[model samples]
Target: MNAPQTIIGQSPALSAALDHLSALATIDRPVLVIGERGTGKELGAERLHFLSSRWSEQFIKVNCGAITESLLESELFGHEAGAFTGATKRHIGRFERADGGSLFLDELGTMSLRLQEKLLRLIEYGEFERVGGSSTLKVDVRIIAATNADLRGMANNGQFRWDLLDRLTFDVVRLPPLRERPGDIEELAQHFAVRMSSDLGWSLFPGFTDEAMETLKGCRWPGNVRELKNAVERSLFRWGRDDAAVDEVVVDPFANFAGPFGGDSTAEDLADVSDSPERLSTGLPPRRDWPIDFQQCVTEYAKAILLEALEEASQQQKVAAELLGLSYDQLRGLMRKHDLRTRPPRRVSNPRK
Candidate 1:
């Protein structure tokens, strides 16, 4: 058996789900885990198996929906050599391999009615016949199935076997979605960000700014924990500053984006500088009587363009340089000459602490 990692969350909804899972772990009967996508149904199954009496034995897993109907039967029940075309060697099935342990059947609602009948028999009688073999084989295996689909409703529609549903649903554990467990979002986001920072060879994770955390907390994560992790990692990568808190959270990377990298046309890019107040207007007076001081006007214009690019790039110096078509050294020199800084220098937080 593989060592199970901890699931990161302590919300009441999640705590109740874990408590229910622990209660059913010792029963040795089939269990059904129901949850939406990315809600950690597979993790729940792992917890169930590892905590059960069969923890020392094999814990096999198969996705019923991922395989075809014809192949699924042979996969669950071993096929004898020459059982069909290309069946050269005797193939042991998941049930046989999981004997005396647990078998996790994910996407159980997708199993065909015929295969469901065979599975029901195995659960009830603890015996099944391998494909192309006459003798019956028996195994003492516990079943732990999971699905996002509604199995009971499918059974009512004749898409699933009613008996199999009844056998599998001896106990059901439903995981709460991320939005329902709002208190866990910050911790989960920090955990993901810290791991991402480490992968990028950073000594510390700067963490999120107040505005960034508020943006994360206010959003409803439709894709749940997985979505939140992706958003956090993506935002940090785009921010590209390990020494500063992330001030932006890009929940949807594709929202309103155009061109190659969600950028406007090159001409439009230059318009920010062109439309500045310091730019010579079409209604300028005679050259000798012009009211604006040329040197001061030029200095203010450069500062305005620099600040605009910085704001557009979320204060990322490298990206702001790219936006202005300036080299990194050139941008640094400009900022130094203009007495400008993105934000006050702050100490980076030790992620380990």
Candidate 2:
């Protein structure tokens, strides 16, 4: 029953997407929304529904991945009483509830082949029979399917139905990930900060310092805007100082003084890390090499460790962050600080419908 969130961003990548969505909104056909997690696929779907001629009708949402196949079928198509073991009463499905409106199916790739067929039939003919029900029901429902998965690849592998994919692709709305729209990072951060500030009953929202904004902009938010919003709100809440500018954003709450290796990081852990027997014997110089540049040695050692971890994790930043016991942002900061490149920044062109 929840409405879609407000879409915020002035970046061309986002603006173009919005414009494309607006154009497609009036066309009452199945639309596929593709994007990484937190890229506002649902919001796009909501806009499509609200702007359509069926704006006054229901906007039902279903996460295909969250429910099991059998339950999902029943949920989508409804069921008569005694349809299954738990069917004590007649059930109304999402298709029935979403009659004359929009039905947003999230994680569409997770739907089973059988359900996909039924869905395809419904889309094509605008009619379907509920589970264990003899009566065929017809409903004028617009389909808005969203997924982060590779549906084309899945169809190629026979995991998803090509026919279903074909039907759903009457139009496609590909949302740009947060990394692709870096220009909006500060604006989003400020928006989140203000909302969080108001939640805390503050008179005025103090802004982020230059360092904090840099911290916000440095990392690739794999979870996209949702992750960024969490980081900003958490940093503001932890800062708890409304009067002063937020000088640090805690992108990773788990990061500690022990760097990435985040156990019970005591002083002993710190000393032991630097003064390990292997490090002293192989990595560092003895008293004879006391004149060695200490800072440079430490830098080289840190970089070596980081490189080793990255290699072990196959250069996946999130995996490397996990292996190093650091948050994604912390790992990114360390990589940047050490002048390490995991991979080149990728620019994904948003698809125009």
Candidate 3:
């Protein structure tokens, strides 16, 4: 079994969550972890499983929202040969595989009503038959569910099963969002910076400037901890060096778009542009009485951004790719598409005396 990942942060909110999680770990009932996206609900589930008696057994995970209803049913319950067109052989399901262990059901709120009934059966009695098999299989498995949705509201609205919600919420752990736990921002940012630097082959990690730290702490992270990690890593990649510290940090690229358009537009204005159908449908005004090709305009704008990123990186393709949030191959493909090439800077010749 893999060890539980270290949960970072010392805020009162985080400390309260850990206390509840520690108490939940001692019991053998179903556990439900609720939190916003990127707030680390899955980590809480792992902590529960690893701290329980079933630590040595398999810890199977399934993203309930990522699959269709038909596939989810087959995934949770094994399918027999010729089970609904594509089953070639008898396959065991996650429940059977995680027998005497733990099964982590992520995005539990997205589960269909029908599937919720089947899940409730498993919770009530540890018995389920395969898709096309008659044999009823029994398994002693602990279920640790995680979701960003309000399961109680979902149940009240008739979208989710009330009984399943009641069973799964035997011990509930709600992780606080990053904005609420401001104390963790700097620590998590530094942690991400060090890890990113090591991954990028930097000999020394750059430290965040005081101003940059303040900028990070003030922003409202809608994406929470995951967004913070990405922002830190991105800032490090774009502005950091082995010998120098990061002078500034960009928490959000779109947040600082005031300079290009003569300072008339704020970040909120740019964000609200999508809500205007006139802007999206009409695009730019007609030039020389010719219809504007939005696709071509977008392509040219993207190429310009790529060119600027490459130039800023001193013609280093790898560094430029990181700055533009593209993979090496993706950057190369764009370069080829736009006929962009890197060339050495020309040296100036000296004038004769």
Query: C-alpha displacement of 121 in model 1, angstroms?
Result: 0.7
lDDT value, candidate 3, whole model: 0.79
lDDT tens string, model 1, 137-194? Answer: 9999999999999887887888988878888889899999998999999999999999
Ten contiguous residues minimizing lDDT sum, candidate 2: 344-353
Alpha-carbon deviation at 56 in model 1, angstroms? 1.2
Candidate 2 per-residue lDDT over residues 224-265, each given as its tens digit: 999999999888889998999998778766654345544333
Question: Residue 16 of candidate 2: its Cα lDDT?
Answer: 91
What shift in Å separates residue 337 of candidate 2 from its native position after superposition?
A: 13
Cα error, candidate 1, residue 27 (Å)? 1.0
Clashes of each: 0, 0, 0
Each prediction's whole-model lDDT (CA) = 0.81, 0.82, 0.79
Tens digit of lDDT per residue, candidate 3, span 216-332? 776678899999888888888888477887866655554433344322333333333323434232344335445765556555555556666666667776666556554454455
Which pairs clash inside model 2?
A: none
Q: How close is each model in CA RMSD to the real structure?
A: 11.9, 10.5, 11.4
Better of 1 and 3 by lDDT: 1
Ranking by TM-score: 2, 3, 1
Positional deviation of residue 132's Cα in model 1 after best superposition, in angstroms: 2.2
